[model samples]
Target: MKSKLTTTGSRLNPSQRPAICLGMPLYNQTRFLPQALDSLLAQTYGDFNLFVSDDSTEAGPGQIVNSYAAKDQRIVYHRNEYRRGLIDNWRNCFELAGEMDYFAWVGDHDAWHPRWLESMVQILNTCESVVLVYSQNVNIDNNGGILDKKIKPGISTLGMDNTRRPLVVCRQGQGFGNMVYGLVRARALRQAGVFPRVMWPDVILCIKLALIGDIHQVEEKLWFRRRTDRFSMPRQKRALFASYRPWYFKLPWPLVNAWMLTRSPPALAGSETGPQRNLRFNLAAVYFQRWWSKFGGGSWIGSPHEWRRGKATWIRKLKKFRTAVELKSK
Candidate 1:
C-alpha cells in the first residue's frame, strides 16, 4: 500500500494553534521511525502537536507515519512528493509550527524519555526568559543498546549575559550543536531565523538563540541519540544545501558561517538590537579566528589521518576554552 497524508487545506487560526509544536524531519530511517514515534507519542505532555515531514524516497517511512497517525490525531503527517534533502525537510517541518508558543525539532532516529516533553514544557513555563531548554543525552547504538562513551553536556547560558552567550557557543566545538534538538520558544526560533544555509547551521542557530535569550539544560538524560560515525562531508553538503556542484564542496564552510553570523539578524518584526548586532559581528570574528586556526594553519586539511589529528588538537583547545569560561563564570 502506498503511504499518504491528508493535507489540511485550511490553516488554523492563531487562537486555534496548539500550545506546543514538535517538528520532526524524517528521512529513510524506517527501521527506527517506529521507536522514535513511540517515544514521542508516549510523552506525558499531551497538549502538543507533532508535525512529521517525510523526505524518504521509499514508502517505508510514510507507512510508519501513517500507522502512528492513525491512532494519534496529534500526529500531523506531511509527505513530500519529491525528495527535499535534509535541511529543506527540516524547514518544511518548521513551517508547520505556524504561531505556536513552543517548538522543537525531534530527530526521527532519536528516542526521548517519556518525561522529555513534560520536563521541557515545565522549564519553558517557569523560565520566562529562557528561549530554549534541553536535557542531557545518552548515546545509544543502532540496536538501542547503550554505548559506553562519555557524553559531554551542552552549554547552558543560564546566568550569562546575552552579549557573551554567543562567544561560549562559537567556541563550544563539535557535539555542542546538538542543543538544536532541545525545545525552543517559537518566537525565539523565528528570531534566530530557524536554520541558516550553512554547513553547521544548527550551531549558527544556537549562537543566534544565545543572543536572543537564555538557554537551560536539565540534568537528567532524557534524549537517547543513536550514534554512528558513517559521516561523509560531500553527502552532508548535498543533504544540507540541496547542492551538488564540485565548487560547493570546496567552499570554506566555517568561514561562510562566520560571514552569516555577521549579517543583521533575521528581519522578523522585533529582532536584534544595535548592541546585539555588534555582538554578532564580534562573534563572527571569533568564528573566523577559529576557522583560520583550523584551516589556514593547515591543521584541518590533508590526509584522513591528518584530519583526525587536527580534530584532536581542536578538541583540546575547546576543552581549554570551556574550562576558562567555567572558571570566569564562577
Candidate 2:
C-alpha cells in the first residue's frame, strides 16, 4: 500500500520563520541519524527549519525522528508510504522546503560543525552574486575516527564567469559529497530545478547552478563525511540508475550526458557564439576525461593486472584489521 504523506511537529510561525531550510532525505540510516540530527540542532545559526523525509522500510527511522521532533519544533518529519527511490525522495525534500530564503541538503551519515551554517549564511548575505557556499570536509570511518581532511574540488571556480563555471565543474566535480551539502540560494535551486533521476545528477545540478551565479568556498573544515566500504564506483552507478529506471545502465554515459547537456538552463544555451563553441569543446573534453579515467589501462575495467593489485591492497587491509582486533583482545 502507498503510504500517505503525513507531517509531524508544528509549523514555524510566520513572524518567526527561519531564513534557511535544511532537507535530510534518509533510508535505513538509523545508526547515524541521531548524530546527524544533533549536529543540526546544535547549529550556531538557529534560524533554519529542518525537514526529515524518511524513506526507511521499517518504523524505526520515523520513531527516531519523532523523538527529536517532540522536543524541537523546528524539525518537521514526513514518512513516505512506499519507497520513493533516492532521486525522487531528494526531490520531495526540496519540494517540502516551500519558500525559504536558502536551502541545503544534509546527508544522513554526515555531521556539521556548529559554525557551518553561520559562516555560510554570512557569505551569501554579503555577496549578492554567489548562489552557493560550502566549506572543506573531514572524512571519517564507520567508527567515527578521523580518516583524512581534504579540500573539495571545484573551489577554483569561485569568481569565474558564469559561462566558464560549467567547464570548471565538468573537470573537477569528482564527488558530490561536499558540494551537494552546501547551502544554496533557494530561488536559484528552484530556477535550476531539483535533481534529475539519472547517474551523478548532483554534478548536473551543480553545473546548472554555476550557470546561474557564482559559487563560494570557505576554507574552514566544517563538513564531516563518513566513508565506508559499501559500494564501488561501478556498483554506485548501477545502483543509482537501477533505483529509477531498469534500462539506464544499458545506455552509454556519453550519450546520457549529451542528452542532459541539451536540457541545461536557457541562460547557458543562449550564450554568445564564442561561449557556445567553448562550452561544447569543454564538455567534450570532460566526457573524454571521464572515459579515460574509468576504462584506461591503470583502471580496474577488465584489467587483470589491476585486479591483482587490488587483491594485494585488500590483503594489507585484512592484516591491519587483524592487528587492530588483536590489540583489542589484549
Candidate number of the best lDDT? 1
Tens digits of per-residue lDDT for model 2, 165-208: 76776666655556778899998887677777656678777766
Please give the distance, in angstroms, between residue 43's alpha carbon in candidate 2 and its true position after superposition: 0.5
The deviation in Å at residue 23 for candidate 1 is 1.1
How big is the positional error of residue 268 in model 1, measured in Å on the Cα after superposition?
Answer: 6.8
Per-residue lDDT over 65-131 for candidate 1, one digit per residue giving the tens place of the 0 to 100 score: 9988999999999988887777778888989767788999998888999998888877776566688
User: Which whole-number lDDT from 0 to 100 does residue 224 have in model 1?
Assistant: 95
lDDT of 2 at 318: 74
The list of candidate 2 runs beyond 4 A from truth reads 1-18, 149-154, 241-249, 266-285, 288-292, 295-330
Instruction: Give me candidate 1's TM-score against the actual structure.
Output: 0.81
After superposition of all CA atoms, the RMSD between model 2 and the true structure is 9.7
Candidate 2 residue 129 Cα shift, in angstroms, is: 1.6
Query: Which window of ten consecutive residues has the lowest lDDT sum in model 1?
Result: 1-10
Q: After superposition, how far is residue 39 of candidate 1 from its true place, in Å?
A: 0.8
